[model samples]
Target: MIRTLLVGGAGRMGQALGEGLSALSSVDVVGLVDPHEPARLFSAPHFRSLEDVSVAVDAVVDFSRPDSVVLSADWCASHGAGLVVGTTGLSDEQRSRLERAGESVGVILAANFSLGAVLSERFAAMAAPFFDRVEIVELHHDGKVDAPSGTSLVTARAIREARERAGRVTAPEPTERFTLESARGADAGGGVRIHSVRLPGLVAHQEILFGGPGEGLTIRHDSFDRQSFVQGVALALAHVNDQPGFFSGIDHLIG
Candidate 1:
């Protein structure tokens, strides 16, 4: 069994993960790190920081703030433990830190952990080379801090790479002038436009629209509840120790 330390153990996702992993016997929650008072969500000991943990940690699962992820990476690297990061809105430098940890132990960082979301990204990449125009629309709850989301950015990059490998140029940029600044959504590289929406009712959803002569295709994935991520997280944890390096997507684990 993997003796795991869960960061952000008091947050919604952390609590949910604690509850979910309790049902499985492969992972044991050895400790929790959260600033919130009395992090009673789990039976494990709670600490304000990773530096306070005294027990042996075989692996770490981080769903905490972007700043906290760096600490988790460093601890995992120093402790010789595998790491699975689910935190979003990380800066380039923060990502580099996480990648550095992989040099010593297994590390998997994924933008979205829903199985359907991974498949949707794959489908979008497969169809990218055939389309002349492509755009993305991602909707999330208002509590989310990121604008376009890390998922959309990764998806855009995947689409861009797929098209490039096929020797296809990006969609043509529109010449029409806009009356308002930032009218058209943020450009996600490779001429792929991403429109972000934050609403109270939405959970997590994305639509990839592709257009060609006389026809269009739309590939969409939705996560109506946070539980949708449990399966993918479980899959990642199971294989995190198999290969000792950073994996940017869960697609590497999925068949």
Candidate 2:
């Protein structure tokens, strides 16, 4: 049985995870650590700090802020607990810190946990060989702080690597100088342009456009709800302890 401790248990993603974990007989909600105490009691004890918990948890799942992930990673390492992190917008330094922590215990980090999104990334990379021009557009809810979603960055990087391995160079830059800096979206790997959209009533979505000589291909993935991520999180929690290192995507768990 997997006994899990969830940090940021009061947040939206945390609540969804709590309910999902509670439904599994093989899993137990060992404890919850949330600074903003939940209004009602949970199936497990709620504590303000990891130090307050007396139980031995098999894993720690964090849906907290980026700033809190490093601390949680350290705590997990010290306690010999597996970690699954879903927080986004971490700086390069923070990511390095998490990687170091993973040396001691299993750690899995993902920006978007939707299974379809993971497949979309793989498909895009595979299609990169036939396409000469490519661009990525990622859309998310307005509340998301990051401009370009982490999923977009990952996809672009994968596509760039695949193209490089195929010995294909990106098309030359179109504009020597731009009247406005924002005229073109951010430049990602291999000069692939990335456009970000933030709007109300949107969950998470991304599209990869590939252009060849006579035809074009577009691959897209849309996450309509947070429930799309629950299964991925559950899978990570169930198997994280088996691997003792840093893992980046759900593709690794997808067989």
Q: Best lDDT goes to which candidate?
A: 1
Cα-based lDDT for every prediction:
0.89, 0.87
Per-prediction TM-score to the true structure, in the order listed = 0.94, 0.93
Native-structure RMSD, model 1: 1.5
Task: List model 2 lDDT by residue over 1-255, tens digit each.
Answer: 888998988877788778877777777888888888864445788989877878989999998989889989999899999999999999999998889888999999998788899899999999998888999999998888887889999999999999999999888877889899877899996969999999999989999999888999999999887778878888898788986899997788998
Looking at candidate 2, the ten consecutive residues that score lowest on lDDT are 34-43
Tens digits of lDDT, candidate 1, 160-238: 9999999998767875899887788998888899999999988899999999999999999999987788788888889
Candidate 2, residue 11: CA error in Å? 1.3
Superposed model 1: Cα runs more than 4 Å off: 38-40
Clashing pairs in 1: none
lDDT for 214 (candidate 1): 100
